[model samples]
Structures are given as structure tokens and as C-alpha cells.
Target: MPAVTADTLTLPRIAPPAPAAQQRPVRSVTTAPSGYEGEGFPVRRAFAGVSTADLDPFIHMDQMGEVEYAPGEPKGTPWHPHRGFETVTYIIDGIFEHQDSHGGGGEITDGDTQWMTAGSGILHIEKPPEHLVVSGGLFHGIQLWVNLPSANKFNPPRYQDIRGRQASLLSSDDGGALLRVIAGEVGEHKGPGSTFTPITLVHATISPGAQLRVPWRPDFNALAYVLAGNATVGTEARPVRKGQLALFGPGDALTLAAGTSQPAAEPNLEVLLLGGRPIREPVVQYGPFVMNTREEIMQALKDFQSGSFGVIPGERIPHT
Candidate 1:
């Protein structure tokens, strides 16, 4: 993947649109994240194991932190290899620095996002910046694994670093909601990250009693993950709170209304809305490799062991 320089980082601007009429009722299938520890940080795995089959195209989602780390206590994932898919990391707070075999890396701070396509293969490391690790502070973020279609599983690796200010912002006509487009189009706004499959990913915050109706492709499967506060979703008006993932039924649009009461955490309701066209391909995954067949996964392992996964500058470790 080529490094993103100032000349190439362009931000998209779209005029905000009037709120759409409630055309379809939104329904929600609620699920909770299972607790687990990754590397050295604790995480809440929202999509894994049993939920993997239902969230096609999206194999995993991890809610990292919201926990404070004492000085010298912070930790992160070490050198690792990934293939056959892309990883999207959105930083809500603190700072994370990443370095990969392709020599692609940068720091993603509050509200920033990083999208890494591990097409053929790549080894990488992500952790708090050295300064942050020494100073200690709050760290919070979400990481999602998006599965690639079979045809593009072995394509060249790439990366996109999207700064918080570069993301397209859309406001509700009534001034009750704000949305940041990370990928795909939402109303008139478009995100900065390019995706292999047709998908929409947005972070939204709705004010109390405010209603948001966002248009979406009817063919895509849509779902919302609440990051903080409470909100009623879909036409069914099912209530959901933090740490819950809500899968919406078929609909041309998504309807969300924030509760009047103050949320336990933040002042406004925050949720991550994600949708993608189903690939409908058989999924075979092992560790960080996601492919369509077991043989393909085996090939990825062999490539990594043979040091064919590309080289990371200054990396001295070799596969056993």
C-alpha cells in the first residue's frame, strides 16, 4: 500500500439534506459483546463465534477500552499477520500508532480512523504511542474486520488513514443529530475510505427527542451498534443501550430516536450504523486469515512462515 501524503488526502463535502419521512419501520435483534482480553488490553467482542454467521462481510467487531491505563501499564497487539480481509479501526480517544510490513503506518487519535486492506498478506503492529504509554490516560476505540469477496482476497495490500476533521459530517435539518461518514454514502455525504464491497459505515449522535431517518440501499443488510446512551431504533422503536448490537430488518431507511433521559455515560446517544451487500460466499477463517476455503487459509499460513508476507522495516523476528 502506498503511503497517504498531504497531496493525496482529499476530503469530500456534501450538502446536508432534509430529514426523510419515516418510510419503513426499523426492527432490532439485540446482542451483547462477550468479554475477552486481547494482547494486553481488554476488549468486548461484539461479533464472533455464534454471531459470525449472521454478520456476513463483517466477521468481527471489537470495542476496545473506555478503560484508563496507569503509566507504564498500557499494552497493545504486537507483530501479527493478516490476509484475505480488511481491518477498520476507529479511534474515539487517546492515540494509537501502527507500523506494517508494507511500510504503511501512522498515528490515529481521537475521532480518526484507519482502514487496512490485508489483501495478499502483511505483518503489522499497533499500540499506544510511546509517549502515551509513559503518560497513561483513557483509551477507547473500535476495530472491525470486513471480509473480502473471494475474487479480491489475494489482491495487493493497501491502507487509508482518515483524520477526524477529514471525515464528511452531515447534520440533521432540525439540528438534532450529527453523523460522521467513515465509509460509503449517507444522504449526500460520502466517507473518505474506499471499500471493496458496497457498504455504509457511520458514527451518529442524536440529541434527546431528535429523530434521524437515513436512506440506505434496500439490498444491504443493516445493523446498529450502540456505543453510548439509549436510543429507540427502527419502525418497531425497540430500545437499545450501550454495548448492544442491534440488527435491523429489511428496510429502505433507518429510523432512530434518542431518549429524553440523560444517558449514563455521554450526553448524547451514539451509535455505529453499518450495512453491506452480502457476498454470499462460503467463509473459511483461521486466526487473522479470512478466505473462502480451508486450502486458501493454508496457503496464507505458508506464505507468512516463508517470509513472503512482505518485510517490516527493522523487524528481526522470523517465523518458527
Candidate 2:
């Protein structure tokens, strides 16, 4: 669970909510269902039951393993294709190697992020390095799919590798929580990752019994997903735990309080705070392609089948 950390006492403190600030209220809380992804790796389908309308600009998310893999047990995705969206992969406690047909490749470890925009179309693969495969350890991370609007659906493909240390660090007003802004703005601070759509992504660790309240954009839709431990969300204090996601109603600010106690193995409440300006456009998703219409999806298939997504490199790194 070591995505990013800082000594709260030394970090910039978030200003307390103003007296007139309207605290967001919880609209719904749903538990993510356990599932398996690429090569049998465990995952929690974080947006399984959420509506596409409520998750506008954000299509899907998977909370990848918090599991400790025995040597030779780690798994990763095979070569895949994507279009009309961006994939944001944040590694919290392990290493992941990514390679795309367009000559974008890199190794990202603890706290690092790989933001890939599969605009128009692209083929890529994500896997563990040979050494990690031979001597597997802990692996935990998040993979979020951010949808591009109709106008930008055919933009050029691109990639951004955001290192862990580049994240903007801040502290709760009371200095009881650490907030790592990985993308977008939080108050006057901004993260390193550049996004096509406006969005804010923050990973916060709240000490037991601590409270965190921060101003939120009224135009953006707010959501909080528990990565570890337990906590309560919204001004009404709705209970939420690991694998649960809380969606909030429109408001000026949001509030969260960690439970007084937690599992022995997880002593703090770890939450991923995310929100984005709604795209409010039609979304059509096929196996690996996301488009605005059935016709576009058919064209994407034809393009992929015709080798238009770029060819794999002649020399390849075999998966361990």
C-alpha cells in the first residue's frame, strides 16, 4: 500500500472547509466484486455496478492485486489493443513493464504511473520483468480507463510516464492524513500527469480516527474508493470498507473519517479520491475498443484486423 508517502507535519496543509461550504452527501455505496484479470491475476472490479452516466469521462477501473505473489506466481496482461480512451496504470507496491507498438516502453515500480492514450488505436502489453517473475513479491496497483470525448476520440496516441516522486504531496488540515495528488489540481498544487480530460486523482492515507475534508470542484463528479481499511464518507458518515466505492452528490466539499480501529494488517484507511468533468456523450465499448457508435466500433475492428494499429517489434521480450 505504499503508493506515496510524506511526513504530514512537513507537507502543505489543506485549508479547512469554509463555514458556508456545502459538504457533499453520499448518493450510493457499492462493494466491488472479486474477479480475475489477464493471466489469472486477482482483481476487484471497482466500477462493476456503477452506471456509465454516473461515471462519465471514466469508463472502468480495476483494483489490481494487493496479494503477495509467491515466486513464479505473478501474472500480467497479454498484447492488447485499445482506442478512444486513456489507460492510467498506477503501481503502488510492485514493478510493471509496459511496451507499445509505437516505441513507447518503460519499467515502472513502486509509486510510479504509466499513462497511455490509445487514441485512434494502438497495441500494447503489460507484464512483470523477468527478475520479478522469478522472485515474486508484493504487487498492488490500479488501472483506470478514462474515456475521451467524441471530438478527441481520434486524436494521436501518446504516453506519459509519471514517476512517484513527481506527485504533489499535501496534508489534511489537521495533519492527520497524507494526500498524494497524482493528476490534476488539489488546491494550489498540481500533479505531474497531463490528461486529455479534466480530472483529479488523489491517493490518501488517513490515520485511524482522523478526518479529511477538502474542497471539490462543483462541476466535477466525485467518487471515493477504498483501497485498504475502513472509513466513513460524506457528511452523513456512511460506512465504507475495503473494495467499496462511494459516490457523492453535488457539493462544494467532501469529507471522510477513518474508523477508530482497523484490521491488524491494515492500520490506516487508504482511499483513492477521483473526480472528473462529465463528458456526457454516448459510450460504446467492445472487447478492447471504446467508441461513440457501433459503426465506429466496426471500423476499429476492421482497422485492427488489417494491422492498422501498428506492428509488434521483431525482437520481443518473452514473458516469464
lDDT of each: 0.79, 0.92
- For each candidate, how many residue pairs have backbone atoms clashing (under 3 Å)? 3, 0
- Tens digit per residue, CA lDDT, model 1, 1-320: 00111221133322333355334555445566557555769787775433555688788899888789999978889789999999999989778888899867888888888899999999888888777889999988899999999999888999898888877777765667777888998866788889998888988877888887778777788888888888888767888888877776665777788889855567778888999988889999899999998999889899999999987779432211
TM-score per candidate, in order? 0.89, 0.97
Off by over 4 Å in 1: 1-28, 48-53, 315-320
Task: Report the lDDT tens digits of candidate 2 across residue range 120-192.
Answer: 8999999988888999999999999999988888898998989999999999999999999999987778888
Backbone clash total, candidate 2: 0
Give residue 230's error in model 1 in angstroms: 0.8
